[model samples]
Target: MKAVAFVGYKKSGKTTTIEKVARILKEKGYRVVIVKSMHVDFDREGSDTWRFSRVADAVLVHAHDTDALLFRAKDINALFSMVSADIFLLEGFKSIKHVPKVICAREESEVRELNDGLGIAVSGVIASSGIREIEGLPVIDATKEPEKLAEIVEKRGFMLPNIDCGLCGFNCAEMAKLIVRGEKTIKDCVVLSSKPKVTVKIDGQVLPLKDWVQELVEKTIKGMLSAMKGYREGRRIEIIIRD
Candidate 1:
């Protein structure tokens, strides 16, 4: 998966530009997911979603036509893991450093607020305002040429699960940097891989057990499973050790 952010102040056309860019990418046969951040209170005081919030952190509303999740937590990383798509377009999340961003603004001053070394391109109303580049970043007209913007994002964007689990020998942020430098591949993320991994730690050091030890552990697990009444050969099981 690949990702980029559409960032700007309130009403600066970030949402509109994201919508256009998502449409353009989808029309080109790419699956896209849009993640937006809202500052104001979005839930009503006395609504079904509000009532669900009182009892649960996440509520899935499933009706005949559509299904939506009303989630209260502000964990973008968790959300990223749940969504599967070819491209992920983020609105807001200006402070996140793991992903590149396209800054949209109505004025040059708003464009200046973007962090250094984070922006991949500029867009929205400010892109067509005679300033072709800011801080050496190229400007792409998001409203008029959304396909071009989508292409740029497709070429340059990347995604990390953002869980910081460190199973890949690097945190999500470190993996993102490595990916940009061509030193790492997305498949290196163990969390997203089809095969599961087991780690052993003893006395504050990770233990790299030998192949024979691993084989012994597997056989021992199978032996224990053979004692169970409903044991099956194809079932997968997980075991955890605290110490």
Candidate 2:
């Protein structure tokens, strides 16, 4: 899925621009998920989930038509594997450089402070100041031309696997900026496009394999599965090893 981060200080119009852009993408039939970053407590005070959180490390409230998993963690990448969407609208994460960004600002000084070579567009109250471009980034009026803003996002936004294998000569975040600037394509990302025959991840991080090692693992697994009942030439199988 492609992801775009909207980042600025509090009350910098990040929410409004994200909402407008999400509406336009939805109208175009793209499934969008907005992930907001905040430090506020989620569960209501004295509620069942809140009470459970006092003793438990995590709380899962299985409410009707919705489910909430409350945990004391702040990493946004934790949700990437759990969520399915065409686009991800990140509400915060100013320091994350892997995804495309729209910098929201109310003044020119704010724009100068926010641009860090990752921003694709500039929006917010600063867009009303009648300026066209700031630091070579387009100034888009999200309220008046949300479609235009959405198109920019659709064109430039991307989510890399962030494996940083170094096969691409640069890091994933650097590659994202190159893609946005027309210097590179998504095809340049080896991890994002790789279809490994045998994959392994320990503790949420993928373990890269050599070419010969991957072939050996794939062959061994296929040979073992070939003798199983109901096994076909191209069947999908999963194995879980636990201590």
Candidate 3:
């Protein structure tokens, strides 16, 4: 999935800007998912949602027009696994480094915060400052021309599995920052990398492991084989992951 963030201080027009971008992307036939990060409480006592919240690890409330999933977690990768989309418009999460971000600045000082390596554009109040660029990046009008802002995201934004599987020597979040820095690629994700077939079974039941598991097993087997002084790195190997 491709992703970008709309971030700013309170009342900096993040919601409005994201809405506009969502509409524009939808018009172009791209499925979009909006994720907002906040510290507010989302539960109301004595409601059905509250009741379900007490009994399940996750609570799903489905109505005629709305569906909500409630869980005591804030992992964005987990949400990514649950939702499928072409574009993910993130609101808040100012500290996440993997995806490109458009800043919604209401003041000049807020614009300064966009210096992080992940920023691709600026919007909101700063867009009208007659400044064409900040920190060498374009200043866009997310409200007046969301398509243009969307274009910036399409060109620079990115998404990852966010599983933090640690196969590429870094978690998904860390890998994202590396990718933004030109230190990695999608193939660096062991899950997305091509490899020889290796089957694993536990107690006579075949089971599948994620990409990181493959990495761990391959390394462990390679190490063991090398200890005998006859095995080499490119030799064929097979191993099983079991409890």
Candidate 4:
């Protein structure tokens, strides 16, 4: 699924920007999901779900049309795997590098302090102020021109597997920075987008392979598959071994 984050200072118009973007994405027939990173005190102290959390490791509150699952976990990827969508619009999560970010700011300095390399564009109140760009990042008026923002996101937004294995010299977050800066393209990622790439993961950790090694593995797999029934040329193969 495609994913992007919305970040800004308090009351920087992140909510409004996300709402507008979601509307445009929905109009274009894309299923959208919004994930917000918020403070810990979102649940009321005496609420039913909150009260249950004191005694249970996981709490599920089923209401009219919503099922809220509350649990304590440090790994976010586990939680994310449960959600499926065509487009994921995230609010907050300023530090996550797995997805491109749209910065909502009140001033230029806020953009400077908030940007880390994953930023794809600038929006929010700062966009209405006539700032066309900040540090080479385009400023988009998400409130007035959400379609343009949505278009940019559709072309550039990316979601990376959260494993930090360093096959690209730098980690995933570092590669994400290079991507937004135009130094690297999404196809450069060895696992998801690369052509004829060989990726091996042991217990969810990616193993680094040189180019020659990848070619060797790919060729060997192709040759082996050539003799199998119903095997077509250039088809991808995945082998799973469980002991």
Best by TM-score: 2
lDDT for residue 166 in candidate 1, whole number 0-100 = 71
Each model's TM-score? 0.71, 0.83, 0.72, 0.75
Q: What is candidate 1's lDDT per residue for 27-134, written digit by digit as tens?
A: 889989988877877777788889888989688888899988877544665567566788899999888867877888888777788744557788878877777788
Please give the lDDT score for candidate 3.
0.75
lDDT of 3 by residue, 1-243 (tens): 788888888877788889888898899899999998878667878887888889988888788999988886556655665678998999998887667678888776787865466667888777766777876677877767889987777666787656565757887777776766668776787654645355565443233466566688777777678878667777676555555
Ranking 1 against 2 by TM-score, winner: 2
Model 4 C-alpha lDDT per residue in residues 1-243, reported as the tens digit of each score: 678899998989999999999999999999888888878786789987788899997887788988788886546555565567888888998888777899999999999998987888999988999889997899999878999999988888887766665656667888888888889876767666654477786645456667889889888988888988999976768988776
Q: Clash number for every model?
A: 0, 0, 0, 0
Off by over 4 Å in 1: 44-48, 56-67, 81-84, 107-109, 167-170, 181-194, 197-220, 226-243
lDDT of each: 0.76, 0.84, 0.75, 0.83
- The top-ranked prediction according to lDDT is 2
lDDT per residue for candidate 2 within 1-243, as digits (tens), equals: 799999898888999999999999999999999999877766778988888888997887787899877775434555675668999999988988788899999988888888777889999888878898999999998988899999999988887766667777898778978987889888888766777777887645566665678899879988988988888887676877776
Worst 10 residues of 1 by lDDT: 196-205
Q: What is the RMSD, in Å, between candidate 3 and the native fold over all Cα?
A: 7.3
Better of 3 and 4 by lDDT: 4
